[model samples]
Target chain A: METQLFVQIALNGWNQQVARAEKFFNGLSDEAFQRTVGAGKNRIIYLYGHLTAYHDMLKETLGLGTATHSFLVNDFLKNADDVKANMPSVAELRQYWAEVHNELNVLFAALPAEDWFKRHNAMTDEDFKKDPTRNRLSVLLSRTNHIAYHFGQLVLA
Target chain B: METQLFVQIALNGWNQQVARAEKFFNGLSDEAFQRTVGAGKNRIIYLYGHLTAYHDMLKETLGLGTATHSFLVNDFLKNADDVKANMPSVAELRQYWAEVHNELNVLFAALPAEDWFKRHNAMTDEDFKKDPTRNRLSVLLSRTNHIAYHFGQLVLA
Candidate 1:
């Protein structure tokens, strides 16, 4: 597959990584996820929500995409583990995980090949015209990096 | 750029993530890295070498490239923290990190655009002919996920 077809190949790889990361999460002990991990004070659950929130936010930024976990944005984004008392249940977070991926998968599969090059959500025609790099492909590339970064964290957890 | 030239765009993003990960590594305190991270028995140093060695091995697997850290493959690959006594010093592993990345950057830049779709190192010409999916693009995609997965692990350190 060349460029356009490369989209599906890339998307498949991303979905696999998400599955791989969730597997790591599933293997973790409850206490382990609740405690601070590595150098950061954030617990494993915080990172989980952090990742979910990122995908949810991406839904808005990428344009033409729907978010599955808008409710997570406030408590999880940049909150880290500080608000432990208010954090969502692990069951709810796990549900958000599946919902986010499912939503993205359906939404993405429906987008025609040309749409991958179009500008996402909030950017205006003039803004996109000025900065052509902020297209759908660029967002896809960034999200892959984002998920991989978190996947690495999950490995440690 | 479309699919073929999309190589460079993807490469640029991978490089930026590597830079971002290295920045995180550079910021860690000595004690923090030595401590057990999260629920895993492995330490930060092992994860560091794990990532570097993966790229090093990928260098050979994807073909037309040489591994920079051959010494590390036996020790770091699949060994995990079990062989900590035999593991390379943190300083030495850090050196391998830079060496492996430098080696890959030079090697990849030299490849022609079409080389990306060519067969990888070990796959038989006949086999690859049957399964064209195992081309240079797939290798590139896998390595990107690998690095991102490991990069996430480093964030915890």
Candidate 2:
């Protein structure tokens, strides 16, 4: 296949997979989602919350947000216990997760092909030097699999 | 699109994207691939290595290999320094990378749609309550974007 055609097909396929995966996730019950198979384990609710946080982070890094980027995985892990302590009821959590999904759709749709290689603005932290253009998308794309990976685990669990 | 059609398209697209990304990565300088940036500070080389590891891991998980399944990310991280310590001259790394890419093609070509979600006879350590079936093809479909993500990063960097 021609390169452009290949890319188009891949992008279309991604949208379809996301739609299906989202629906599957939405179908879970709060009890099923919240069940801790083992103590301090990753319940469905926790996984969704983590997905929500990371997607938001991707949005911020891609410069798709009006607000500054504040969500860090470290911060989430640091506050993991606290976040889980106040875990929303399953229904409420699903609603939040769906919103995050919608946000991802919007951000991805708005991504300009021309900006695909532009370096991102310098991160405030000296430690971070993310090339503004491509790393955001790369990291974002990796997280999509990350979500799928964990979701697969949750389904199996 | 219909669910089956969507999955098929995803599979094709993923396969194509990995090829495109692999070519793009292979053309880059070792220094370029090794530079650290972004929120995660991951380099291009690191991503290339991880992709290779995950491809092999998926093959094993799907029972495509006689070799026992190895810890995916763990082994890569553990051997990260040694793997990079005497980095093959750029030419050698590219050759190695191409071999993996060829292996990916072979793996993809052999995968049947029906086998995408089939559970393996050997139980995985994952906490699955039941032996659920999943298309092994789904993982490959999802990983296409994962490779693209890093490719985008390399371009921007």
Candidate 3:
């Protein structure tokens, strides 16, 4: 019930989901990663890139630091997959995935417990004050669910 | 953050996901609901039933009440879908989904804020003491992610 404990629960859930996704993608072959979940649906590669791009932004969103993989934003986040678009190699994206999450892990670990209750950069102070639920921990919780949701789709790939 | 606020965030996340999924499924035609996420993967109807069955069990898991749709457990929860299996009609499962969640909304609304910190029926007292994060709110948080995960898959249908 303490703030530290509450923050720990949110962080643990985020870590658990990130681990699950990492393991799932790590075990996938490059060919399998290229396969779409279904005909004409987003490819596994795109989802992997999408997740990496989103988490890369989480650094800024959480007020931890700037995004390390900002270049991926236009390709993966701004647009749906276009088979002809220039994109990173699966190998490159794999490395980005590791680096981004590893960096996030360290940043997240060093975050003071009380900071989790503070508003992230994405929210206006006025909006966050009106609904305190839109704090940093809430972003982590929502993004944790976001990862799980995508992981669910990835499993069907 | 206070315990009441933390609990509200978790419950609100759960409600938001449930509403998203409910809207998605409600808008789907029976033909679309019957379509599989991928070849030989879960059908949307199966996921709907599975979610209903899982939420039905949440009543007991949260120690709010016994499962009202106990009969759905074996078909929807314990076993993978079989084309030949005697499953509920799509219409029938749709009705169950609404009923189960509606009942859960009432039960969840009545739960005291402090009670969210208590261990549910699923965990032993010693286990809960060892890791208080495994409380009723934790279960809700995990299940909220579970729904989001499946909803991610369902959208591909």
Which candidate leads in DockQ?
3
Model 1, CA-based lDDT? 0.73
The better candidate by lDDT, 1 or 3, is 3
Top TM-score hit: 3
RMSD of each: 3.4, 14.2, 1.4
Q: What is the full ranking by DockQ, best candidate first?
A: 3, 1, 2
Tens digit of lDDT per residue, candidate 2, span B1-157? 1223334545555665676767777677777876642434455666666666666566666677632223335534446523345444556556656666576567656766445545553465363224232234444555665565455444434
Most lDDT-accurate candidate: 3
What is the per-residue lDDT of model 2 for residues A1-157, given as tens digits with 9 covering 90 to 100?
Answer: 1222223333454465466557767777666775532345556666666666666566666677642223334433346534337555667656666776677677667765444334444354343333222334334444555555455445433
Q: In model 1 chain A, which range of ten residues has the least summed lDDT?
A: A1-10
Tens digit per residue, CA lDDT, model 3, B83-112: 777988889988999999999989888988
Q: Is candidate 1 or candidate 2 better by TM-score?
A: 1
Flag regions of model 2 displaced more than 4 Å.
Answer: A1-17, A37-40, A67-77, A81-84, A121-134, B1-157
Tens digit per residue, CA lDDT, model 1, B39-150 = 5566777777777888888888888677767788776786657644677877787788898888888888898776777888869999988877677777777777676767
Local error of candidate 1 at A124, Å?
5.7
Worst 10 residues of 3 chain A by lDDT: A1-10
Candidate 3 per-residue C-alpha lDDT over A41-78 given as tens digits, one digit per residue, 9 for 90 to 100? 88999999999999999999988999999999999999
TM-score of each model, in listed order: 0.82, 0.45, 0.96
